[model samples]
Target: MNMDLTHVLDVAQLTDVGKKRDHNEDSVASDVSSGLLVLADGMGGYQAGEVASKMAVLTIMAEMKERLAGSSSGKIDVASGMQMESTLLRDAVAKANAGIYHASRTQPQCAGMGTTLVVALFTNDRVLVGHVGDSRMYRLRGDAFCQITLDHSLLQEQIRAGLITPEQARFSNHRNLVTRALGVDSVVELELHEHDVEAGDIYLMCSDGLSDLVEDDDIYLALRTLNANLTFAARHLVEMANDNGGYDNISVILARPRQPYSAGRHWRHRILGWLK
Candidate 1:
């Protein structure tokens, strides 16, 4: 696809303090130029929660921006499609993890504080999704909205083990106990997924706030019917979460793939149609 004619991105972000939380601890950033959307949820017992999240968002994106600034977008011949796109996303996640861990060690108050990270990178007709911790990425296609990344949490493990039903785990005390996070260790394992994009597709990268307060079915239903407007989806998702008894900070970053008809392509098609 030509860079000019390929699907470009339109992004919207929204955050909330929720019904119980005094301050929002989640952070979201979108780089329309690079087609990058990142969301981080901080975990800490005290004020460090906000601190960790702030550091996480700033460090991760700063590193990613620096890397992209010097990037060559790879060769057009060998690297194309999902393979090249996924590699770029993986490298950025790795860099973010390393940066978070380094800050944890260097900063005193930041110790024992970590964050869940979810990133979505759009390249051509594919979206590369990567995550560490309970944060998530979702894609809406046609009439269905499905989670693209798996959650890294004890509750999820129990559900997988069949030790607890998903309904039971929804209210389980272990729901907040994340098994993986960006700054919790020197190395973090990331779950990566790639999906084919459609012209009307919508992508959501969100913190745990939405998942914790709102039900999965509700979220899916909302996204399934959500307008193509990215801002509408972002704002309404947070509002619904707040109304449903939000006890935590909520941050949502939304990006939609936009397919534009090029004048040349349109005229060519019209001419061909008339000739036929």
Candidate 2:
């Protein structure tokens, strides 16, 4: 059975140029009807970063929407054994990477341009998240707040190797150095994972602009205090980043499922209805 999340999910998003940057290079998009949310943080010269980020967000969203129109999210793929929604998101990210990589090679101004991408698709009472680079997704359930996506950055690699403590890595000069990003190469690998969603769970997708400046504890408090109002929670997060010297473009997407979105109808029930 397919579930419609249009009314089940509450979503809010915001982006800012930030205190230091002359122009914003981050892009964000959300479709409540499709239960899709995407965020990209661009890195490049002049307006090239902005172009790359916008291209990624638009391309991914368009690809997913077109494919989803004809298929059920709960269907399983024979080859990968993953659900249709997960495969769709993976393919969409690949398409977006190809488009951006092609443009970077063909356009002189866009040379060396790339963007970090994070996307979430909510279906069957679960969220399938795909990401590249340092852009991230976080989840807040009950009193626990934790990061959902692991960054593809130098700092993260160091932490994994035990070269630096997570606390020390936070103060490292190489925090902005991402080891992997879309458009930087001909092919980019997207890390995808699935998480169960519960009612009252708040998911945050944001650029490093917010994560780099605000501490995790502060973010948790803000979300816990303002979960009732997602709009205010999103705004407060961006404001906190700016207050801490927003050195980069800031973007955020906050989504909450107000109630359980169980997949409609069991197989036996459907069979009975057909007989009736």
User: Could you say which candidate leads in lDDT?
Assistant: 2
lDDT of 2 by residue, 1-276 (tens): 245578789999999999999999999999888888999999898899999999999999999888888887689999999998888888888898999999999999999899999999888778989999999999999999999999999999999999999999889999999999999988899999999999899999999999999999999999999999999999999999999998988999999998777565334555899999
- Least accurate 10 contiguous residues by lDDT in model 2: 261-270
The numbered model that scores best in TM-score is 2
- Candidate 1 pairs with clashing backbones: none
Runs in model 2 deviating more than 4 A are 265-276
**Runs in model 1 lying further than 4 Å from the true structure:** 1-7, 72-85, 260-276
Q: How much is the lDDT of residue 186 in candidate 1?
A: 82
Count: clashes, candidate 2? 0
lDDT on C-alpha atoms for all candidate structures: 0.75, 0.91
In the predicted model 2, the residue pairs found to clash are: none
Residues 162-263, model 1: lDDT tens digits: 999988988787788889987778888878876777877878888889988887778777777676567887888999988988878898887776763333
Q: What TM-score would candidate 2 get against the native? A: 0.95
